[model samples]
Target: MRRPLSLFLSAVALMMTATALAAPHPVPLSELFPNSGHARSAIIINKVLERYHYRKVKLDNAFARQVLAKYLAALDPNRAFFLARDVERFENGARRLEENLRRGELDAAFDIFRVYRMRVDERVAGALKLLDGQFDFGRAESYAFPPSSASSPSTARWAQDSAELDELWRKRVKNDFLTLRLAGKADPEIRERLQKRYEGLARRIHQFNGDDVFQTFMNAYTETLEPHTSYMSPSTSENFDISMKLSLEGIGAVLRGDNEYTVVQSTVPGGPARESGQIHAGDQIVGVAQGLDGALEDVVGWRLEDVVDKIRGPKGSVVRLQLLSKSSGSTAQTREVSLVRNEIKLEDQAAKTFVVDPLANAPGLKIGVIEIPAFYRDFAAEGAGNQDFRSTTRDVRKLVEQLVAQGVDGILIDLRANGGGSLAEATSLAGLFIDTGPVVQVKDNFGKVEVETDTDPGVAYNGPLAVLVDRDSASASEIFAAAIQDYGRGLIIGEPTFGKGTVQTLIDLNRYVPGEHNDLGRLRLTMAEFFRISGGSTQLRGVEPDIRFPGADYLTNHGERSLDNALPWTQIKPADYKRVGQVSVDRLAQQSAERIAQDVGFRMLTERSKLMRDAEAQTQVSLRETERREEDKRRERAFKELQNRFLQARGITPVDEDADQIDEDALDAQRKAIARIEVDEAARILADRILMERERQPRAVMKD
Candidate 1:
C-alpha cells in the first residue's frame, strides 16, 4: 500500500534540491515502408537515424536518398571506395534499391548488400591496419581473462609460454586467410579446410564486428531519432539490462573483446567480484563454467556475444571462471567466486540531493536542492502495491513537503544530467509544484493536438525556487523545467539544455499477417513534439537560462540542438498562471557573475574545458601512436590540474598515490559529503537573504 503523504514527506525532507533545469510528431502507417525489404532497411536505418535525433524522415525516396548519402559518407567520406566517377553511380544503385525491392527483386537488393558489405569490410580492414601501424605489439602487455559460461576455473588457458601464444596467433591468422579463399563452393578438400578455418575466423570477426558495427549503427540510428528510441541487438540489450539493473550472476564483471580475447572492462562496485577485489579491469576471460561439475569450454576463439550468454544465469547459481592476472604474463593465476544475484539499484546514478544557501546573497535561508537523475518508474512494483518504489514524481513530492515542514526558505530542482524517462511521470511530477495550469502541448502527425495540464489545485511547497540545467539535461527534464518556468514559480538557471524535442512510438510490423511480408520490425516513428506552456517548442532550441552560469557548454560541440536533422524550434499559445513577485534577476545575475569571477576553481575548469575543446576539434588521426599517446597525456595533465584545484577549493587533500585515479569509492563518498555541505550552504544563503531584506524594511511586521 502507498504510504501516507506525511510519512513520505518525513523520509524525503532532508534531501537537498538545488534546482537544475533540465516531443515528437506522428507518421502515416502506409506511406512509411512499402515492402518487406524496404521495411527491414527502413527499420534498421530509422533506428540509427532516431538515435541521432533525425525524426523528420518518413522513409520515402527523398528520405532514403538523403540518409544513404550520409550513411555512405560516414563509411567513406572522401568517396574513395567507388571513386568520384562512380559516386553518383553508387548512390543511384542505393536509391533504386527500395524501388526494386517493392517489385519483389530480392536478388537486386542482395547485390546492394553485397556491395555495402564489401565497402564495410574494406573500412574495417583499413581501421585495423591503421591500428596495427600506430601501436607496437611488443609494448602490449598481457592481462587476466574473465571466466566465460563455457569455460571452467580449472581450464589452463592463454598458453603457458609467450612462444606458444605467438604460434597460436599464427595459426589463427593462417586459418582466417584460408577461410577467405574457400568462401565460394568449388573443391571439397579445399572447402573442408576452408570451413574449419572459416568457423574460427567468423567467430573472431563476429567479436570485432559486434563492437564496431553495433556501436556505430546503433549510434547512427539513435542520432536520427530523438535521442531515446534505439535498436539494441539482443547482446547490447543484455549489457544495458545489466548496467541499468546493476546485477549479473556471472562473475560480477563487465567484459568486452579486445583483439581476440574477451577483456574484463570493470567490476561492478558492491558486487561479489568487487567486494572480493580479486578481479579487476584489463583482466582477460579465457574460459567459464556453470558450477564445479560443469564442463570447461575454451572461449578464446568464441564470439563475445555467445560467451556473454553462457555467463549470465539465475540467482544463487555458481559459475566458475578462469581469469589471467594483468600483472602476470602466460603464467597466470585463477580465482572462483560464487555470487547471488539481486536487484542492484545504482545509487550513484539515481536521484540525489545537496544543499546550497547562496549565503553571499541570501543569509540564513534554508534551501533544499534535489537533483533528479531521471524519470524512473517501477511499473511492475507499483502495480503490485509497492507505492514506495523508486520514482521521480513520488520521491520529489515527498522531498518537497518534507523541506517545507523543515522551514526551508527556498528549493532548487537540479535536473542537470537527467536524460529522461516515462512521459506520464514527467507530467505527474510537474503537478507537484504548480497548482493547476496547462503544462505542455503535444502535436501529432495529423496536426491533432493534446494539451496536458496539472489538474491538482494543491502544491507541495511554495517558496523561492530555481531550476538548474545544462546541455545534458533533456526530454522529460525539458518538460518539467518548461512548466516551472512558465508558471513563474522559480528562476531558470544554467546553460541551454539538450533539445531532444521529438517522440517515438514503437509499432511492431509483426502484428500484421505474414504473407504481406511487411517484415517483422518495429517502426519508431515520430509521434508528437512537446511545446512549452509559455509558447515555445523545446525542440531544436532548448530552454534558455534566466540567470546564465559559466560552464563548458558554450565552449564545445554540445546540446541536442547542435545536431543534424533536428526539428525546428517553434512556439505555442501561453498558459494561464499568476505571475509571482520577481526576484531582482538583474541584481542576482550581476552578483553571481562577480562571485564566479573570484572562484579560482571554476576559472581553472573553464580554461581546461577550452583546451579540451581545442583538442577535440582535430578529428584527424595522428601519424604515430606515440604522438597520439602524448596528446592524451596532455589532456590528462590538464584534467589532473583542474581536479586538484577543485579538491583544494573544497578543502580536500589530494590522494594521488593511494587512491584510484578516478576513485569510484572516494567519489561516492565525496558526493555524499558535498551534498551535506551544499544543503547547509543553500539554507544559510536563504536565511541571510531574508535577514537582509528585513533590515532594508525595518518597519515591517509579521503579516500572517
Candidate 2:
C-alpha cells in the first residue's frame, strides 16, 4: 500500500509550494472570533445589497456562499482558470468534504484542500494573464500602499521578471477567491466565466480604476481582523477622501494601479486635472515635481499614495506631473503638464430640479422638493475661507431661500436614500429651519456627552416642511429628523431611518511604528457614538418616521447602526432648547392612517414587500422554475395595482397595454407621477385633517 515516490514528492512539493506562497496565517481564535470582530461581514454585505432592495439572502452563511460565488464568477467567467471538468472536480471535492464532515473525519479535509489549491492555482494563472494584459501603471496612475513594517515588510518592489509578477498576482487572486468563499458565495466555478465577463463589461462601462484590487485587499485585511479592522492603502484612502469631500482640486484625472505603475483611470471634466487634457486613465505617471523649481523624482515602482501626494498641493499652487500616454498607439510619448487646483462647486451633488406642474390643477402650492443625496462639505475651501465651498447646509439654505422667494407653499427635503455625512453640516442644516435649538448629542468612548446646539435665531424659511427619509438615511439624517421632530417644525416621513449613530476617528496606526514605517500611517478607529438631542440614541434603533412610505431594497443599507461594532444606543438629559410652535402630529397621524387604509396601491406594495421579505428570509432556496413563476405573479400584481392607482389618482381611465408599452419617457413619467401622488395625498390629508380638527376645537386656541 506504499505510494509511489513521485506521488509522495508531488504531495510534499505542494505543501512546500503552499508554504512559500504569501498565505494568510490562521488568526488566533481569541483575536478573530465572537466579540473580537462583528462575526457579520456577511450581514454587512447583505445589508448593502438590501439598500438596493435586493430580496435575496438574510445575513447567513448560505448567502455568503452565493455572494462569494458571484464575485468569483464575475472575476473570471470564461472557465479560463478552471478546467471545464473542474466544475465537477470542485463539486466532487465539496462532496467529499461534506461526507467527511458528516463522518467527523477532520483529517480527510486535507483531500479537499489539496484539490481546492490546485483549482486556485489554475484560477491564478488566468488572473495573471489578465493582469499582464490589463494593468498599465504609469504617471497618470496614482496608487498608495501602507508603509512596510517588521511584520509586513515592504512587499512593494517590482518582480524581477514578468512571470514572477504573474505568479505574485496568482497568489493574490487565490487569496481573494478564498476570502470571498468565506464570505458566502457558494457556486465557486459554475457560471464564473460569465460573471467575470459581466464584471469586465461593467468595469468598461464605468471606466473603473482597478478599484477591485484595492477592495479585495481591504477585504482580505479585514477578514484577518475579525471582519472589521481593515487596511486602506494610500490611493484607496484618497479615493475615499474624494468621495467624502464636497470638493477636490488638482487635475481631474482618475489614476489606477497596473502592475508597478499608477495609470490614469479617467478624466474629470472641467477640473484642473482634466483641463491639463494631456492626462487620462491608462496613461502612466513616471514623475511628479512641485512648483517650477522642484526636482523630478522617478515614480515607477513607487506606491500610488506617494505619487498622489506629489500630485496634490495647495490650491492655486502648481504641480507638474509627467505622463506616459497609453492611448497613443505604437510610440507611447511622455508629456509633462502643470495644473493649478481649485474647488468643486455645489451644483454637482444637488438634484436636477424643475418646476413640475404635472397636475396643472394643483397650482401655487409649488412643492419645492430638493433631493439631497449626500451631506457633503468642502473642507479645503472652508479652511481657506472660501465661503463659496459647496456644502449640504449651505446649499440647502440657498435652495430654501430661493424656493421661498419663488413663493413655494411647501418644501420637501427628499433624502430618501441618503447615506449621511458631516455631523457638523447636519446640525448646521437643522438651524436653517428652527430659530435655535440643540440638534444632536455625542458620547465618546468614555461615555462623556457633548450636545451640539444651533445658536442662530434667524429661521431661513418657515413654510410647511416634510423630510423624506428611508432605511438608507443614517447618521446626520437621523440627527436632523430627531431635531425637527423635537421642535415640531416639520413632519419626518418615509420608512424608518437607518440606525447608525457611531462616530469613527481615523487614527494613523503607523504612528506607533518607528522610522519610515510610520509614513502614510495606520487604521481608522470607531471612537464614539452620536445621539439625538432629545436623549435617545439613533444607534441600532433608527428614528421612526411620522408617516411611512414604501422604498426600494437598496435603501436598506443606509444606516451604520446596522453595522457590527456600532456603538449601542443610549440616552442623556434632554437639552433646554425652545421648540417652534407645535404642529399637531395627531391630525397628521390620523390622516396618514386613513390614507393608508384607502390606498390600494400602498396595500399592494406592502403585500409585495412582505412576500419579498419572506422569500429573502428563506434559508433554503427554491427550484429556479418555481421561483420564476412566483416572481412573475408578484410582478404582474404590482404592475396592475400601480396602473389602477394612477388611474384613480389622476381621474383618468386605465391605460391599455398599447399605451402602457409606449416608451421609456412615458414609464419614467409614470414612476415620477406615482411618487408625486404619494406626496400630494399625504400633504392634502395633513392639511385637511389639521384644519378640521382646529375648527372642531373651542375658540381662543392661543393664536395671536
lDDT of each: 0.52, 0.50
TM-score of decoy 1: 0.63
Query: Taking the candidates one at a time, how many backbone clashes does each contain?
Result: 82, 56
lDDT of 1 at 151: 12
How far out, in Å, is residue 248 in model 2? 8.3
- What lDDT score goes with residue 11 in model 1? 14
Model 1 residue 603 distance off true place after TM-score fit, in angstroms: 2.2
Error of 1 at 242 (Å): 13
| Per-prediction TM-score to the true structure, in the order listed | 0.63, 0.53
